[model samples]
Target: MSAPDQLLVVIDAVARRSDGESVRIAKDVLCAGAAVKLCLPDTPAEFAKALARRGSRRPVVIGDDRALVRAVGLLHRGRELSDGALSLVPVGPHGSVDLAGALGVPLGAVAAARAVLDGAARRLDLLVDDSDGVVVRGLRVPAGPSGLAVIEPGSVWDTCRSLVRTLVRPAPSVPTIRTHRLRVEADGRVLSDLDDPVEGVTVLSRGGVAEVVVRPRAAEPVRVEASAVTISGASFRYRADALVTGPVWTRTWTVRPAAWSLTLPAA
Candidate 1:
């Protein structure tokens, strides 16, 4: 379709602060000379409904990083991402909208909203996992032991006894970082074997390939470019964009080249 003349501005509840700076900036900039439909969604269900009702208007999200992810997930699930260009006006406490900043969206509410009105559409790559989840920034699979620690004691005496035991235990002779055994594949070729312990794995969608980097415990890092990547091992958790998902045994992510477009400042 032709460039969008009307816009659907979906402002997340978190962005609707008492100060209202973000909302005001977005409305003023976007509604200056265009037809705009503004929506304030208090809940996820309301957010979905607002998007579903956005007829031909291009969507502009005004909120933090999570809010951006939510809107993108909805559009991707509905199969409308590729054709519609998205805009973002990140609003929240400082550092809360890092993803938007990383994606080239201006961080200032006024500047971001202005870009939404005056910027150009740039098609960007996306990472789509087997579960149909989308990753906008990147994905990281951490190595070493999971960071979660749990403590349980029957009573105050039990807690004291456990603490005394921990205080008396001998320390290790040599401190070493724990590593995980993972099988990593890129475009069906093995990049890391399960026999090798890995420190971590990072995957990013760049151009038409997935840039895969595998950090081994003792060897030089291995980097490869492929159209897809698959990782299998004991249940492992991964951080995708701004969210953490898994404890999954295996997961595959493929590169969707130029899968969606975003509005950003003109070069």
Candidate 2:
């Protein structure tokens, strides 16, 4: 599809405080290129309200990855992600916008803004859980190396750099191998049972299935591809994208193929 002419520019308050110059640069580039309506939202409610009233204009978020994730979650829940493509400008401290860069958006304010006006909408797959939570990047066990499982972030590498960060992060102090009691199912097929304590579980969205890796301590990681994955344990938390979520006992995530579209620079 062609680029959008009308744009609803949402400059997150954090972005305004962190990097005013980048935000200004994004505004200059976007306003010069299209008809722009800017919204500087200070709170989550305000942000959602602005997006709700965006009307026919495309929403372009200017902030860090958290802002971008918030925008996506709001759009997805509102069932408007597919109707109107979202754009983003990465403006924040280092590591704050890695998800944006991992998603193939330019990190530079000027470049990202120009892409909003000149780029095309690319449909992407996302993981949607039963609780209506969305995972655009990927997720891992939130408890770290000792408590959670650690497996090679394999195929998830194709879609995000967050996994790369995970790989390069400094080693943890934990020396002994540990395990978490969790039962894992992939497409209704049992990959690991509760009897088999897990060291880690990694789930990443790819195509219409989720690339899943289940690791049991001192054993090789079991990999599978499935349309859905379910994990039930002693109320464990997981990192979805940049957010640490749950204490959820049992959680299920299903892949929605090409469910969302983002305005990205054309290849």
Candidate 3:
């Protein structure tokens, strides 16, 4: 007999693939019966509420990376990260689906849904930001790019083409080197103070606390261990996965390990 179905999907209409074609494609693949209850959420909060109500059901998000990040953030905040699986169908602006690629989700909506249905569930790490925002991986921001911002709206065809091109292109290097006087504390120890100027710092941890800074002169990812960390900076923004957030001056992040799971292909 086939395994019992235990998957639920919630979608954000404002995010990527909010059009008719993408939606139809997702509905055709992911929402085909009593196994999956596909919900079209008008807002992120509503989606979160629906997800919280569906205990034990795996979450399959059908939007861009930002939508996926939002779902992850909700789980982290709800303290239910270790319980279920989260999958994605990346349908958004170009470069917005980088996190999906990192998580091994296929580019096409139907293929991604299949991966969710047939892929193996694996434990994955999460990065909690200063504002209590949680991400599956590191954040990225490009400094010297023109005509790359997602603010300007484009046609569906144009957006689709751009998304394809971005996924195939080489990862661009960060050009502008901006520094921040950051105060980072891990566990109970101070890793860096306000006096030091650093380009960027990545706080890495599977569960407990591990941090590494990407400075101008650093040889490799320097290890700094702690149970929790706090970062404070001035007038600067950082990338969280594919989204850019905050000039948030001070925020505290606590390490939560094995906080989430994802379906992956066998290695």
Candidate 4:
């Protein structure tokens, strides 16, 4: 079979160490008897421009999780995510699991890279924040660890002890769980106005909403049957995956169906 003639590929340098092997593998498998241009991008802006200006071809990114997210974010905001196709090679340690897990990228860099060359794209769900930042699955937000959970702060001796403990022992646990006072509105109707902080709220389409997951203290899953949703809170900040954006009193969010297309291993 003949390989496609036009392909646009970008790699992030920061994510290079983790992605280096995969990048090489992609080049090896993809470039073999094929015409291709692989670019190593230093900044997200450059990647965005390259992705936008790409000529009649799908875009592939080789970098850590952030690189993949950034690429998606750009396409989403440019109104290109729904129409554009994306391929990912996990490179960085941080956020790598989240990225790979969400996108179904293989753990091995080479395997992930190979998926790009051979994978097929499918319409999928994506979350958009106030800034239109894109998150594949969801976010994790927790309140700071309580002071008693750690050594005392004032006394020099306590400080020394705390420092040692901090070095040797794990840091205080940031609450893995939280609930937010959310006012969820789908389409235009209010679905919830919970006063208690409930588990994370997911605003997706009907089919997407059916996939909603609530944690230990599960609250009533608010059905957001609309094309858009709005979330607000005064106590806790929101974490979109690894990116923390809002402590706002309120923020609006929307779910656009098939807003992004991701390349996946054919079934």
Per model, state how many residue pairs clash: 0, 3, 3, 7
The residue pairs found clashing in candidate 1 are none
Ranking by lDDT: 2, 1, 3, 4
Best TM-score goes to which candidate? 2
- lDDT (Cα, tens digit) per residue for candidate 1, span 138-256: 88896223222223345678778878987999766888677888999998999888899898899988777889999998999999999889999988888777677777999999899
After superposition, the stretches of candidate 3 with alpha carbons farther than 4 Å from their true spots are 1-4, 15-19, 32-34, 129-131, 140-177, 187-191, 204-211, 217-227
TM-score of 3: 0.73
* Alpha-carbon local distance difference test for all models: 0.84, 0.86, 0.67, 0.62
Better of 2 and 4 by lDDT: 2
Tell me the tens digit of each residue's lDDT in model 2 across 92-144. Answer: 87678888898999999888988888899998899999999899968887446
Off by over 4 Å in 1: 1-3, 17-19, 143-176
Model 3 lDDT per residue over 91-175, tens place: 8766767778877778887777777777777777776766678756764321223223544345678888989998998666866
As a whole number from 0 to 100, the lDDT of residue 216 in candidate 4 is 24
Q: Give the TM-score of candidate 4.
A: 0.72
Between candidates 3 and 4, the one scoring higher on lDDT is: 3
Off by over 4 Å in 2: 1-3, 143-174
- The C-alpha stretches of model 4 lying farther than 4 A from their native spots are 1-4, 140-206, 210-227
lDDT, model 3: 0.67
Per-residue lDDT over 41-61 for candidate 4, one digit per residue giving the tens place of the 0 to 100 score: 677777777888877666777
